[model samples]
Target chain A: MPLNISQPKRKNAISLTPLIDVVFILLLFFMLTSSFVPWRIVDTPLSVATDAPAAPEERVNVILTLKQNNGQVWVNDEVLSLSDSSVFQTLVSDNGDAVFIIQAEDGVTLQSLMSLADRLKLNGAETVSIANAFAMPEAK
Target chain B: MKIAAKYAARKANDDDNMVPLINVVFLMLVFFMVAGQIRKADPIPVIPPQSINDTRAATDPNIEIVVGADNILYVDDVLFTVEDVQAYLEQAFSSAVNPDAFWVQIKADGDIPLDSLRPIFNQVRLAGLTKVSLATQLEREAK
Candidate 1:
């Protein structure tokens, strides 16, 4: 018995393999290049000297002196540990409308200062400002 | 004829098997396209400080000031000196369609010393831009 083999002729058939390949590559690129980390913002209204209204006598000034290596936070003359949240809580409650001036000492990072400011804001302290030791001369 | 019919059926079954895979890949493509924010990479990548403030930066400010870990400043991807930052910002402010609506965002490295950033802040203030935002990441809780 002899078998005659004939190839099947298919009309206008397109392979889905290439399309799938391209889609997979695009998915991989998005997965790797995209950042999942959420971004937040801290709104700061830069106070001009002349326009800044004079501080009321009743409003307390809480100076947060930050040092490097997670050093103690000095709120005014009293020293408090960075981890002690209750102290900061009470401080904010006592002076609800206090102006918190975050004074960063030498070697202190912007991270530490912002973290402290965040904590203070969380504790209900209003008006957090950075104390500029090297205050640049006003634009002449 | 029977063998050809069997081969055609097999090919149809193989194509059917890929339907689910194509569906999944298409879904993933759509997910990334919608969920991910495609932002232009900053000239100087800054690891923003973490904060509890979850307020999303609503508007994409016209100006983005990046402060690198080395205290270098880049205003809108252009390298700028401490003195030049104010000038650039002022010019941008003046030329803006809505000066009041025009704002600045400071994306400073988390580890950068605070004193180094003071100058940048001063420049923003001197530019007469009352609205400024400091870009930050969500503070991760202790694991």
Candidate 2:
């Protein structure tokens, strides 16, 4: 028996097998690597400085306290706005060798404290230390 | 006519081939290894405070200590009571090549009180890990 077969016609179709595979792979790669929280680090003043002995030499010390309840920073008896750079400038000018003793109440964010400390450092304060040691936050 | 008959007679062998698939998978695996760090996720949600002068560290932290909301402590995403931290650090420091040079990163929530973080610092100090650092992100203005 003789079989007569017509040659198959070429169809205009692009193969998507590789393309689909690549798209899936790329999707999976991003899903695995992306973190819900992209945590970064900023170190604040030394909290351990509370244990260190007091300085032998009498140097200027500016006290700043953070009351978490009020969400305001206090320098001595006066409330200070963090927005003002001149506050730091005035403090630094008063005593070039001044040290800022920053004390924050429980539940205050470390980020805000660190920024203030950094600002002090930038304004020429030789040392900015956490005045009080860390402890368990008061159960509120 | 002979060539067409020959081609039709043999089954397409390439349909069963998986070489390209395997190659693509291998490349993806390598990309994940190189492009990302595999650090454990912090159990509690923490919004780290921002600072204008914050600087990114040159190296990844050797140890991760997270202070979550409600004053809970986490060491490398593993929950640790305040009491357990000293012992844990003792082990980490003892195993390190340079105990004194060992770097620590503290990731604390913005509102985490200083009192809540004190014990962790003490524990870190007791372990003789002097090179302690607090982790913070860049301020939005800086970003």
Candidate 3:
């Protein structure tokens, strides 16, 4: 009589090494990209209405004020010299859509404000809002 | 004879089947590279002020005005005087649609003077823009 022989079964296993490598690479890429991104810092007063906050569409606030000496003006805290066209050019170069909020002083001349407004209009600031400090006591 | 045939078949296919793995890795690499390319830069660096309750989500393609510790102003990375800011906004408004939909976010430092922010608000209104937002960090009280 001839002896019968049986074949051994082979196990199919999924390889995880490639998947893990891909995941680690993706994680590293995100970490590096996030670090290079610029961050913005702003200082502002608190609002009373916690229930209704400003919409996301309206978030860029351009703080404008005049310096005490020689009536030199500062926008968002940066002093501007009238002779420099670059300053005005830079203001208009913002690619992102941002709301412009003008916070002028009580005694600030309208002429200065108007002149600045004209430039902002050229730069693509679609929505510009004026903030009246006197109207809101909380702002003080 | 059956056992010998089965073993021979198993050994025939085991020589470095890494082509498929390489193909998948390369595909993912290309996918991430394309995705990373589309991200745009933020116009400006704005650290919003802290609020007891800040529930506002971040907006996309929005303008940011950052107020530094020394009360310095930056609009989309460019430094401007109060007058320059107004002029910039005015220029921006002429070409914008509805002029009323534009949103300006102000991120002011905690120690900055309240008086410093006055002119910015004034000019925003003058430009005919009504939508404005203040950025702030949410305060988490210690438990």
**iRMSD values, candidates in order:** 2.4, 5.2, 11.0
CA deviation > 4 Å runs, candidate 2: A1-14, A35-59, A69-71, A121-126, A131-140, B1-40
**Residue B50 deviation, candidate 1, in Å?**
0.8
lDDT of 3 by residue, A1-140 (tens): 77676546556456656665776687567545543212332223334234686667546656655443233558765887644656756765662456666555544433344334444554556654433431233544
Candidate 1 lDDT over B21-100, as tens digits, reads 99999999989988987777889777888877788977888899999999988888989899998889889988999876
Q: After superposition, how far is residue B22 of candidate 3 from its true place, in Å?
A: 18
Positional deviation of residue A104's Cα in model 1 after best superposition, in angstroms: 1.2
- Candidate lDDT values, in order: 0.80, 0.69, 0.54
Model 1 segments more than 4 A misplaced = A1-14, A49-58, A131-140, B1-20, B140-143
Task: Report clashes for each candidate as comma-separated counts.
Answer: 0, 10, 88
Whose lDDT is greatest here?
A: 1
Q: Of the candidates numbered 2 and 3, which has the greater TM-score value?
A: 2
Model 1 Cα shift for residue A28 (angstroms): 4.2
lDDT for A29 in candidate 2 is 63
TM-score of chain A of each: 0.70, 0.59, 0.46
State the lDDT of candidate 1 residue by residue for A62-116, as single tens digits.
Answer: 7778766484788767888767788888988888787887776767887787777
How well does each candidate superpose onto the true structure, as a TM-score?
A: 0.80, 0.68, 0.41
As for lDDT, the candidate ahead, 2 or 3, is 2
DockQ, each predicted model: 0.55, 0.30, 0.05
C-alpha lDDT of candidate 3 relative to the true structure: 0.54
User: Which portions of model 3 miss their true places by more than 4 Å?
Assistant: A1-15, A29-140, B1-46, B55-62, B77-81
